[model samples]
Target chain A: MNRNRWLLLPLLLTLLFGFSLSLGSVRIPFGQILTILAGGDATEPVWADIVWNFRLTKALTCLLAGGGLALAGLQMQTLFRNALAGPDVLGLSAGASLAVALIFMGQAAGIRLLYEPSPWTTALVASGGCFAVVVIMLAIAQRLRDNVSLLLVGMMISAAVSSFVGILQFVSKAEEMQIYIVWTFGSLGSLNWPEIAVLTATLAAGTFLAIRSAKALNAWLLGQHYAQSLGVPIKRSRMIIILSTCILTGGVTAFCGPIGFVGLAVPHLVKLLIRTSDHKILIPASMAGGAALMLFCDVLAQLPGSTQVLPINAVTALIGAPVVIWVILRHPRMLP
Target chain B: MSPDTPTIALQTHALSTGYNNPVLHLLENMSLTLHAGELVCLMGPNGVGKSTLMRTLAGLQRPLAGSVTLEGGPGMPPEHQVAVVLTEKIAGVNMTVYELVTFGRYPYLDWNMRLREEDKKIIGQAISQTRIHGFTHKKLYELSDGQLQLVMIARALAQDTAVILLDEPTAHLDLNNRVEIMKLLQRLARETGKAILVATHELDLALQTADILWVAGKDKTLLTGLPEDLVLQGTLDEIFQLKGYDLKTGQIYHTAFRNKTVALHGEGYLYRWTRNALERNGYNIAASTPTDVTLTIEPGDRPAWQLRRGTATNLYYSLGELLKALPK
Candidate 1:
């Protein structure tokens, strides 16, 4: 049964990845899709252009951001030893949101703004916000004795950063607010190759860090003291785990605009299918599962008959929240 | 230490330990050593620094001063050298018994957590050692409290350390479970040749199971000796006596006894309980049988107590009936 789950997860993920690529506003033929993917010429070159430039990039972004945020969430949940903990638990997304909000609403706040509304500039400011929160959290972690306290501190920082964003929204122009609000809705399609490369690099770094600390994460299941007794250097392992969480969470938030529910929901969702809490399996599984769920949600966000796409954030919550509820109901003791 | 002598598996030198947040110091300037194949129980009343000291020894908390070492090495030993079964509840972990036990092989396994042949053998032995093979596939949340405690001990056993420390392994368990856990710890210490230390509130259980008693003293020190010596010397009474209970005589203060002193003759477990029943009813036992009332015990499948009161003999089958027939 366990071996079957291992085989099934990737098979399901591949099918979703293919299905996500196929379903856009314009209906592309599956033959042409495969042909275009194989680097062959399509009957209409525009079909190849559409498949290469838009759908493929969007689908890959879904894969990277979804998987990254979900892995980040798993690290946080295990590190904090909390069921409700997610990538946003350490205020990374909130910090990125604040930075993006600041950049979008800067002119209305009587600040001189030089940047264009390009993905690069937006990503730059979002990254700035993410680092700012990381620095603040690392500083607080020094004085704090326990992870629970640090988690509480992260929540407080999130609250403070959120209030700043709320105030910025209140004074901003409708056009500026619209930009910020749309960013909050989250995006997967706007990124070109360069941004995706950076996202991939961040995902790679975070996944590496997570894998390096997989044993520590497993030992952490016995709680902090037991983990320490098992020869895990608590401070170092915790820092590595936190670093992974920050990079993965921040990278996704920076490029994709603070995607919701995926980070908070994906680990639980993956565990439901996999039936184990072992991080060695969970790390890769969650990444694949997160990617699949994101693709699935991105497909759901597009209106069935029209080009009008709902907010990616709304689609994830609508989809993620129920799946989590189902997971919890299926096993009342699912959370740790 | 030489191989001929018992190895000092764990030792602490002048260790002062406690929490730093509230600035409370628990144990002060204490030196203690634990030898291999010995199970020592640290006993004391509440807030007596037994847990703080255990935590200190387990290397969970930093000592205010001094150091704890395994063998002749400095600082704490690695996971392969020492294992600890803590009181922390493994709640909502979503791991099976086998998975949790496999955690004991953390130091042995690589980053991927794949077990070698020997590692698998060690884990199997640990499961059988703690006798939790029955539910190896069951999730932690599915097990009862006693069963979960056994799983935890099994995980520790899988560590295969020379030194093991358990903090209240019997806590939150029923009477049978309590004995089972303590007995398991004692057996593990002997069979594995490990130096095991237990911090517990179970004075009676500890007295029976521990090879040595480390009683927390009034001056923030450990009073270490054999269990019988500690009990006979009234060292065990000092702390528990504050609650008006005597550990030496196994009697409570303010238990008013009747002035009647009866001579009851008996032996073995039944005799002991029979004497207990008589004493509970305020009747005293005397060495001299020439006193007013002499009750002779008749031992059999169904034991009987014979009462000879000035040549008027009477017999009762049960202690309950005999006590009732006598005056209050």
Candidate 2:
């Protein structure tokens, strides 16, 4: 079954990615998309500009957001042993949003220290925020012991950060608030090459770490004691899992607004489709599943013939929420 | 074959294991040796630190004081010398029986986690030894408790260590399953020449199957000897400190003796049970024949009981009515 799925995935991904690039407000032809992709001039200058500069970047953004979030979610689920666990649920995304919000509000208030930060500065700050949350979570996990309690604590931390962002929204002016609100809506069409480069690097690093930890994660499925008996150094594996999750989620959230549903829903969706929990298979499978789902959702967000694009988060929630619900109702014991 | 004389697979020198939170010390100054080719049972009451000692021995937790040493060769590491099977269930493990057991070779696997032919052979040997080769492809959730326990034992076996430690391997099993698992472990120990240390609450099974008994004795001490020797030396009784059960005869004593007395005359198992019924009904059983009242069992095609109270004889078919009619 997995072999069949593996054969089908690339074709599906290509078809969806093609659909994403083709059916926008401008409605570029498939032939022209191929021409532009192959470095030739399209029939029209406008088509090339839209296809190469805008649609291609947006499509790649969707892939990165999808794959990175899904892998991060898989790592979090295995690490915490909770099916409901995800990048957003653990407040890592909220941490990134908090960092971005602080900068937006700081820039709006004319703060000299941060004074009109660049996209790179924003990404770094977001990573710092994510790193801080992971550290706090690790500390709490050390003392807390129970996975459910730790998840609850993560939810509480997210709530606390959300309120802080709420305060920032209240204090900011109309223009700055609009920018932040639009960011919170999550957009794929706005990623430039520089931002994509940063996202790519972070994704590559996080994916490397995740794949390396696959064996340890497999041992972890039995749980910590049994994993330890198998010679998995518990503390080190945990640290690596958390680090990878933070980099993946934080990097993406810094570029795209906190895209929901992909992280929490994709792993379960893949597991449901494939029926295996081996992380060696899961990490890559999640990447493919994540990328496919994101592109599909991004196309839905585009609405094809319509001019206005839906918020990626909204489209994902419309689909991802039901998948999560299905997972919960169908496999109640999946979560610890 | 004394424990000290035999080749030691694992040993502890004055080991004291406990938690630091409340500054509570459980076992202190405990020195013991676990010998190869022997099945040892660590028996104690609940909260007597059996798990603590097991974890300490397995190197899962640091002992409060003292040291645990494995008799490994110069090149062999401690992890290669010992393997542990914990009571913690492998929850949500989405792997086949084969994959689960193959994890036992983790210490020897390379960074790529590619199993060699030798590793596969060891895994196959482990599966066959634990008799779980029939379900090598089946998921863990599909197995029963007994089968899962065997799979875990197979995992430890695949580690190919000199010593194996299990925390309640027979727990959550029925009588027959418990006996089967115990016998399997005993066979593995003897055949493979690996020391097997099992911490369990099943006293009867332990006493019946274990080659040696390591009783966590009263007041933070240790007792190690043969199972019969421990039983004869009263160490089992001291360690368990059970109130109603007699360690020597393996009989339960009803502590609440009534003022009334009864003399029962019967033979064999029937006599034993009749006395038990009378005793449970608050009758002080007289060893010699009594004059006031006496109960007699007449066994035949229709078994009956007769109660004689000053020649006013009453015959009852069942002991229940006989006990009920005895002027309460």
Among the numbered candidates, top lDDT falls to 1
Interface RMSD of 2: 2.1
Off by over 4 Å in 1: A323-335, B1-4, B75-77, B242-244, B251-263, B282-294, B308-312
lDDT of each: 0.85, 0.84
Candidate 1: tens digits of C-alpha lDDT, residues A18-38: 988888888898888999999
DockQ for each of the predicted structures, in order?
A: 0.64, 0.44
Q: Report residue B36 deviation for candidate 2 (angstroms).
A: 0.9
Model 2 deviation from native, Cα RMSD in Å: 3.7
DockQ of 1: 0.64
lDDT score, candidate 1, position B326: 68
Off by over 4 Å in 2: A1-8, A39-41, A107-120, A134-156, A330-336, B1-4, B73-75, B254-328
Evaluated at residue A307, the lDDT of candidate 1 is 88
The number of residue pairs in model 1 that clash at the backbone is 0
TM-score of each: 0.94, 0.88
Pairs clashing within candidate 2: none
lDDT of 1 by residue, B1-328 (tens): 5777898988888889887778888878888999999999998878888878887887788999998887736543467777888887554456899998888988777778889999999999999998888889998879999999999889888988888889888888999999998998899889988899998888888988999989885777778999999888877777566586667766554343687777877788877887778877778777575766778889899889988767787999998888887655
Candidate with maximal DockQ: 1
Question: Whose TM-score is greatest here?
Answer: 1
Clashing pairs in 1: none
